[model samples]
Target: MIQKKAYRFLLFLILQSCTQAQTFNKAKLDSFFVALNKNDQSMGNIAISANGVLVYQNAIGFSQINKGAKTPATIDTKYRVGSITKMFTAVMIFQLIDEGKLSFETPLARYFPQLPNASKINIREMLDHRSGLHNFTSDSLYSTYMGSLSLKLK
Candidate 1:
């Protein structure tokens, strides 16, 4: 009887811990975002899910910070991914390499020979940002083009 009681207690504790871990505390998360916003440390929307269920989602700050009129950010707001794309591209390249479809030593020219100096660049060099390729976003006209595109989308 004592052994059975102990086992029951252990099972109860395990179930309690599991449920506690799965419980999403939205109020606490919201307060954290509020503090971040007050300190000018955070912007944009964030969604968190567990077990295929959305547990928390919130959007804070302006989509477009304008002195005259600011556009409030929403959950559906689209933001420029910027350098994040590079990380994602690197992950995909590595996955391809793992799948035997590509290799780190593969020359860029194999895929994009039209790119300047592609023959001299390897997949590893590109992933490491050592390909010496010009960043198009660094061009002075890039922001102008992006702003025009944003206006058209709006």
Candidate 2:
């Protein structure tokens, strides 16, 4: 078993090293930015990266419309990204499951025992947004505390 694993590892490394990496031109990217500016695009940002390299980023318009502050789109730009990050998290979690290190039926409470119905929820269900965790980010009272992020669908 160990020998087979080592052989597979070596083959993976060889394939990785044998591949040619792709490159892009800054001038072409700058032209796109110029067009964006020409259109007076407001409050917009874009991020592009490949193989751990930051290939493109541009933030145009105002970060704060009231104060009129400009922020250039860059990889470091805090765009919230929202569910996109969640997508990546889901992919990594799926990969773990694929490798047999994780499972779909694992209870959510295993990690967050504080949940009222942790035993009923699972990571797989959470990834699918079907864990029945109630959203509590909205309320007139607890809204200040729990907001609307309920572990179980209310």
lDDT per residue as tens, model 1, 38-81? 65555789876667887677888778887868787888888878
Report every candidate's CA lDDT: 0.78, 0.62
TM-score of each: 0.64, 0.54
Candidate 2 residue-wise lDDT, 16-107, digit = tens: 44343355555655564565456554345665566776666666654333355654444344443446888899999899899998899988
Instruction: Name the lDDT value of residue 79 in candidate 2.
Output: 43
Rate residue 22 of model 2 by lDDT. 54
Candidate 1 lowest-lDDT run of ten: 10-19
Clashes of each: 0, 18
What are the C-alpha RMSDs, in order, of all predicted structures? 10.7, 13.3
